[model samples]
Target: MTAQVKYDDVEVGTEIPAQTYQIDRMNLVMYAGASGDFNPIHWRENFARKVGLPDVIAHGMYTMAQGGRFVTDWVGDPGAVLDYGVRFSAPVVVPDEGGAALEISGKVEQKLDDNRVVVALTARSSEQKVLTRAKAVVRLA
Candidate 1:
């Protein structure tokens, strides 16, 4: 897919629109059913605590996907993202009462050759960063 944004019009520090995605237990259950990652740690708080986690946690991939969503929505083409990666720096603790919120934003980090640019991402939950060194290399129109 071709990006709607033009590479020539993009600046090195341009900010992508920020987005916040809410994750609840039901969401985790649905993702578990779809991804077949039925780890008890993601769905059972008591089991998670027994295993050393503070609470039921959202899947790391789920958090990372929010970052991807932020980038793709800004570029206007999911297929325009050539490369994406992140390091799971912290766990997103989903409490039984309110679940969790994943906040994502990106900036044009650098302009690459061939109409491609590097996007730096930040993903946070409850003021703590969940993803670090997140970036996407996107090919723009």
Candidate 2:
């Protein structure tokens, strides 16, 4: 685990290290089982095509969870998060053989009272953003 981030030491515009996460059919299946979100669009390509999607895509919540991971990983504690949200801008298309790659990075956008900071996030897949306006407020040590 990383050392805890201290509020006094962090400032607006500080950048968090980027992370790349891989998602595949098995990941979607596991998420479906755990989240009860077994939507076909997340796993079945033909069904996704029928529904007007380019291919099987990842769940919005799963993508959001990745955002959460980015925050928690930085803060070094899940309990540090006070607020987190995002806007799903596009789908993370999952191909059968190679899986999809979610490239995520964050920057400090705001510093608030009570030892908190807002971290702005960007998540991309397939050369396009999958989530936008994503931010997390974290209370640091």
Cα lDDT tens digits for candidate 1, 69-140 = 888888888889999999999999989998898989889999999999999999889999899999999999
Screening candidate 1 with a backbone cut-off below 3 angstroms (N, C-alpha, C), the clashing residue pairs are none
Candidate 2 contains a number of clashing pairs equal to 0
Model 2 agreement with the true structure over 65-135: per-residue lDDT tens digits: 99999899989999999999999999899999999999999999999999999999999998999998999
Query: Number of the top candidate by TM-score?
Result: 2
Cα error of candidate 1 at position 123, Å: 0.6
**Residue 77 in candidate 2, Cα distance off native in Å:** 0.7
Question: Model 1 off-target regions past 4 Å?
Answer: 1-3
User: For all candidates, what are the clash counts?
Assistant: 0, 0
Residue 41 alpha-carbon offset, candidate 1, angstroms: 0.7
* lDDT score, candidate 1, position 39: 99
